[model samples]
Target: MSKKNNKIYLDFAATTPVDREVLKVMMPYFSEKFGNASSTHSFGQEAIAAVDKARETIAQCFNCDFSEIIFTGSATEANNLAILGIVKNVQKFHIISTKIEHESVLEPLKELEKSGHEITYLTVDKTGLIKIADLEKAIKDNTILISVIYANNEIGTIQPIKEIGKLLEKINKKRKEGGLSKIYLHTDAVQAINYLECRPDWLKIDLLTFSGHKIYGPKGIGGLYIRKNSPLSPIIFGGGQEFGLRSGTENVASIVGLAKAVESAFNNKVKNFKKVSDLRNQMLADIIKHSGESAKLNGSPKSCLPNILSIRFSGLSNETLIVALDRAGVAVSAGAACSSRALAVSHVLIAIGLTPKQVKESIRISLGKDITAREIKMATEIINKTIQNLL
Candidate 1:
C-alpha cells in the first residue's frame, strides 16, 4: 500500500480518518481532563460531565433521550450486546433477520439458533432489499425481535427500514390488542449514519447500533440506543457502567471524538452528500464508459447509499483489481474489510443473486467526505487502466 498521504482512499466503508476538528476536541480528555468518570473527586466530576454531554449530543442526533444511549467499545460489541442481551431474557422465541447482515449480527443469531431459538433469515431481491411481505410472513406467535441492516456495508443498498419499522409497530399494536407480547425492531445503522436519516423514533426502532470510525471519529467507541423499558440482560459483568449494559472504564477521548464527529456529520450532511454523490456518479460514468459492456453495477442505482459504488467486470478477478488499484495508489476493496481476508466470495454478493463468477469479479468503491473530483477522475483513470491490463 502507498504511504497514507500518497494514496487516494476510496475505502471509506471500511473506516475513515478522524477529522482534525474531532481530534482537537479529544486531546484534552486524553491527558489534562483525564480522570476516571466513576471517581467522586473534582477531576472525576469533570470527566463525567464531559461524558454526559457527549451522550446528550449523540442522543440529540438520534432523537432519543440521553438515558437510552449505552456506550460500548465498538459497533461489533454493541451489536453482540443487543442481540445476545435481548435473546437471553426470552426462553423460547423466534427471531427474524436477513442473510446480508454484518458478521457481528449473523454470528450471534447462529449462536441463538444453536441454543434452539428459531431464526428466519429473510431473502433480498436483486436490488439488495428485503420484501416487507417476507418479513411479515416470518413473524410468529413467539416472535421476539427483528434485526436488519440499515444500509449494507458491502453493496451500499439502503433497506426499507422505515417500512419495516412501521410494519412491526402495527404488528405490536395488534399483539397489544390481543394481550400478547410485542416484537421489537433493531437496526445496525453503522453504514447509514453519514447518508441517511437515523432518528430512532421516526424509524420506530427499539434498538439501533452505530460506531465512530465510520464517521471520521476515533475507533474503539460506539453506542447502542435502547428504547425505554426495553428488556435486556447485561452481556458483560463488572462494575456497573452504561446502565450495567456495557461495563468498563469509559473511553473518554473516543467518546468526546464521537460526539464531535456526529455533530460535524449532521451539520454538513446535505452539502457533503451533494459533493460526494456527484463525484461518485461521475466516477461511475467514467468507469462504465471505459470498461464498456464488460462492467455492470451491482446494487440499485436509485436506492443505494450516495457515496458507494459496487460494480463487477465480467470475467475479471476482484482480487487482482484490488491489488492493482492499491499498487496504482488508489485504495478500494473486494468486500467488507472484516471479511476481505477470507478466500471465499462475499456472502452479500451471493445473497443478492450473484453467481460465484460475478462475485469474484465484484469490487466496492466507497467515497469519503473529503474526496475531490480530480481524485475521482484520476482514480477512475487508474481503475480503467488496471481493468484493461487485467482483461
Candidate 2:
C-alpha cells in the first residue's frame, strides 16, 4: 500500500495509464492553444479548428460521418444523453436494458422509472450473453428504446450486437407496416471501441457511446454517435455546442488527445489483439495449473474480450485476495471500480447466474498494451500462492 510498493498496474479495464505519445500531444494545448472555442478571435478559431479535426478523426475511427459523433464529458454522460435524449420525445413510457449495464445506463433508467416509465431488465446466459429471443419476448407495445452494452465491463463478454441490430431492424419494419413508430437501439460500446472490430454504421447502431479514458486517452472527454435524424433532447442547456445535442464549451485539449489515442489504438489493434490474447490465456493457464480445482472462471473463455480475465477462488473473498495481491506487488481490480466500495456482488456476475459465494470470490484482471507474458506468469503465481496461504 505504500508509495514504494504500488505494484504493476494490471487493471486496464478500470483505466489505463496515459500513453506517453498521447500526453505529448496534449501538453501544448494546456497553455499554448488554450482558448475558448466559442470566441471569435484568432486563438479561438484555431482551437475550433483543432476540435473539428479531432471530431473528424473520431468519426473516421468509428467509420461514421463526422456530424454523427457528439463529444461529451465522459461515456457516462454520453450514455445519459443517448438514452434520456431519445426517451424525452416519446409518448411510450417503456425501455429495455440489460442488468449488466454500467451505472451510467442503470442510473438514468432508474430515474426514468421514478418518472413512472416502465423499464425491463433483461437477463443474460451463463456466458453473459443476452438471448435475442428473450429480447424479442420483452418487447412491448409501449417499449420505445433498447440500450444494451456492446461488451461487458467486468467479465468482458462481447454481446451479439449485430444480431440484436438485425432483430431491432425487423421490429422497425413491422412497426412501419403497422403504422407505428419504431423503437430506437443504443449501445454503450465504451469497453468495445478500441479492443475489437467496431463499425457503427455496418452494425446498424443508432447511438453508440464510448469513453476517452477507457481507450488510453485523457479523462473527461468521450463521445456519443447519434445517427442522423434521431429523436433526441439535450439534457444540458447552454451555448448550443455539438449541434445543440450536447451543450457547453468543448474540452479541446482532451478532445484532441482522445482522437490521437483512438487512432493509435486502432493502428495497433491487430498486433495488440494477438499479444493480449496470448497473455490472457497464459495467465489463465497459470492460475488453473497452479491454483488447482478451487479456481473458477466466470465467463466463457472464447467469447470474452481478449484483455480481461475474471476468476473466482473458492473460499476466498475478492477483498482479501486484492489486499494479498497488492502486498505482493500486483494490481488487479475487485470488480467494477465504481461499485467496489459498496461490497455488493457484481451485477454482471449475478446476471450470468453466478452464486453469491462465487460473486464474492471473484476478481477482474485486465491486461494493458504494455503488460508482458512474463509479468502475467508472476502475477498468476502470486495469486495462486496467496490463495493457497489464505485458504
Candidate 3:
C-alpha cells in the first residue's frame, strides 16, 4: 500500500471531522436562516425554531425535557457552567471529584476551593476507576456536588456511573430525612456519547456535559443537561438565553449540526461501535505480535471505550513515536490535545501509577467510525517499523 494514498487518522478523541450530512443540515442556517435566536421577528423566529428543535432532539437523547438543555460554546464551557453554577449560591460547601477529570472541571473546582469551599480530589485505581467507598467517606454534611468524567479521555477507562448514581440517590434520601442539602451528581460525558449509555434517567445524574465536535458535529457547540429542580445558578449573565444559564446569541448553525450529529450517532451507534472495536482489537493484536515484550496496553483490558487504544512501549519516547507515525501518514496523540503543548507528564498517567518514564513512552490511538481494516493494518505496520527505527 502506498503511504501517500490515505492519511490514517487515529486521533478521534481529540476531535472528529464533521460528518458531511451534518454539515449539509447546517448550511442553510448559516446563510439563508441567519437570524439571532433571541430576536422576535420572522428571521429571528425561524432561527429560534431551529434552536428549539435542536434542543428537543438532544433532550430526547438524554431523556430530559427540552427546557432543561442549555447550549454552550463548548464542552469546557458546559463543564464550567455545571461546576460553577451549582456552587453559585452556596457560601461554603464541600465538593468531590476525581483527579483524572478534564481541566475544565478541575479548574473550576480549584476556583471554588479558593473561595473557601472544601474540595476533595479523589484518587483512582490503576484502572482509572474510583472506589465507591472512598467517595462515600469523602461526602460530608456540607458536600454539595460530585463531578466525575464518565469515560477517561486518554486511558478510556469507564467509571461506574450507574453505581455512583445509585449511591448518591441513597445518600440524598438520607440527607433529605436529616434536613440537609442533597448532593447532586454531574458527569462530563463528552467522550461517552458515541459508545456508552448516556440517558440522564438511566445514569441518574443530575447534570451532564457534552461536546458536538467529539461526535462528528461542528465545533464550538455543546450542551448541558440539568434535571428539573436541579440546584444551579447562572454562570453567564446576559440576554438570558439558554434559560438564563448560558446567555449569548445562539450558534444556530452549529446547534442544528449538533442535533443532526446526535441523531446520526444514536441511529448507527451499535454498528459503528462494533466496527471500530473490531478494528481496535485487530490493531492491538498486530502491535503485540510485531513488537512482542516491548509493547504494553494501558488502561483496563475490559470496560474501556471500544474506540480508544492507549499503548506504551518500553524504552521509547511517546513524542518520538508520534512524530515518526505522523511522518508515515498516521496521526495519533500523546494525551489530551489541549495539554499536548506542555510536554509535562500526564496527571492521568501518573495517577494510574505509571512512572515518569512509562508516561513518556505512552501514546493514545483513538479510532473513528470511518476507519477501515486496510487503514488499521497499514497504520500498525507503520507503527511497528517506526518503533524498530526508534529503538
Candidate 4:
C-alpha cells in the first residue's frame, strides 16, 4: 500500500492514478483538440493524428507494428475481443484456458461453450501456476486458442508465460506442418504491463490485452496487440475503426494518456521494481515478525509479482479486516475489486486450493510505485494492531 494524501491504498492491482505526464499529454484532447476522429475536417485530422501517434507509441513499446495495436474501451473489452472475436464465425472448436483467468476471459469462454465450443479449463498447482505438461497435454487436435493470465490480479502469481509461449511455438510449428489448426496464444496482461516483460515477439503471443488505468494511465482506454495474421473478427461493429476490430469514436484523451503511461512504465520499470520489491519484502518481514504464527503468505513467494502480497491471517475474516482497515484510512481488498461485493468466496483462492474458511482469512495487498518505507511500517503496525484487537 502507498500513502496518498492521508490514505494508505494497497489496491494497485485494481487501478492506479493517472500519472502527471500522462495527464499533461491528455489535457488537450478533452476540449482543445475535441473532434470526432471520423470527421473529415481538420479537427478530425488532428484527433486522428493523436490516435495514430498513440497507437504507434504503444506498438513500439510492445515491439509490435503500428497495424497490430487495436484500442478498446477497457481490458475487459480487449479480452472479450481476443477470446470471442477469434472464433466469431467458427464454432464447435476447442479452446484451452486456465481456471484462474479473470472473469472477463472466463465469461467469454463460457459464452463460447453455450454455442457448442469445447473449453478445457486447466488447473493450477497449490502455488497458482499452470504446468507446461498439463497445458501441452490439454491441446487437442481441434484446439484453436489458449488464453491465460500473465499474472493473477488477486494472488499475484506470475505464470510461466515465456515458457508457455515457447512451448506453443514448437507445438504450433508441428500443427502447421500437420495441416492442423494453428493454436493462437492470448494473455490478459492487465497486471503485467507495468512490471513484466510485455514484448509480443518475446512472449510469442498471438494476442495481448492490457488496460490504461492499471498502468497509471486514464480509465476508459486500453489496447489489444493482435499479431499480424492472427485470425480475429470484430466483436463491436460500426465505422471500421481500429482496423475493424473495434468500432467507436476513440477516447482520444485516454488514448493519449495510455501511450504516455506505457512509455513511463517501460522506462522506469526496473528502477520501480527494485524499490517497491524491497518495500514489499521488508513489509512482509515486519508483519510476520509481529504476528508470528498468525500471519502466513499466500501465493508463490518466488514466482509472483514484486509488488503484490496475498496474506492469510488465521482466525481473521478478510471482510472484517478490510472494513476495519478502511475505517483506519488503509484501503485494501479481499480479492478482485470487480467481484468483491459478491458473497461467494474468491474463485481465485478456491482454485489455488484454499478452503472456504481460509479464503475468508486471506486479503490481497498490492503496492504501487509510490509506496514508501514509512507507509509500509505504519501499515504493518496498524494491521497487526487491528488483528490483535479483532482477536
Question: 1-391, model 3: which lDDT tens digit per residue?
Answer: 2224577889999999999999999999978999898888999999999999999998887778999998999999999999999988887899999999998999899988888789999999888889999999999999999999999999999999999999999989989999999899999999999988889999999999999999999999998999999888988888999888888989999999999998888778899889989999999999999899999988887889999999999999999989888988899999998999998788999999899999999999999988889889888898999999888
What C-alpha lDDT do the candidate models reach, one value each? 0.91, 0.87, 0.91, 0.90
TM-score of each: 0.98, 0.97, 0.98, 0.98
Candidate 4 collision pairs: none
How accurate locally is residue 376 in candidate 2, as Cα lDDT from 0 to 100? 75
Candidate 1 C-alpha lDDT tens digits along 109-194: 99989998899999998889999999998899999999999999998999998999988888999999998798989999999888
Worst 10 residues of 3 by lDDT: 1-10
Candidate ranking (lDDT, best to worst): 3, 1, 4, 2
For 207-282, candidate 2 gives per-residue lDDT tens digits of 9998889888988998899988888899999999999988898899999999998888878888888898998998
Model 3 pairs in collision: none
lDDT of 4 by residue, 1-391 (tens): 3565688988898889888889999999988999988889999999999999999999889988999999999999999999989888775699999999999999998988887789999999888999989999999998989999999998889998889899999998998999998899999999998889999999989999999999999988888999999889998899999988899988999999999999999898899888988989998998899889989888899998888999999999999999998888788898898898885688889998989999999999989998888888888788888888987
Please provide the root mean square deviation of candidate 3 (C-alpha atoms, Å): 1.6
Off by over 4 Å in 3: 1-5
* lDDT of model number 2: 0.87
Worst 10 residues of 1 by lDDT: 1-10
Clashes of 1: 0
Error of 3 at 380 (Å): 0.7
lDDT for model 4 comes to 0.90
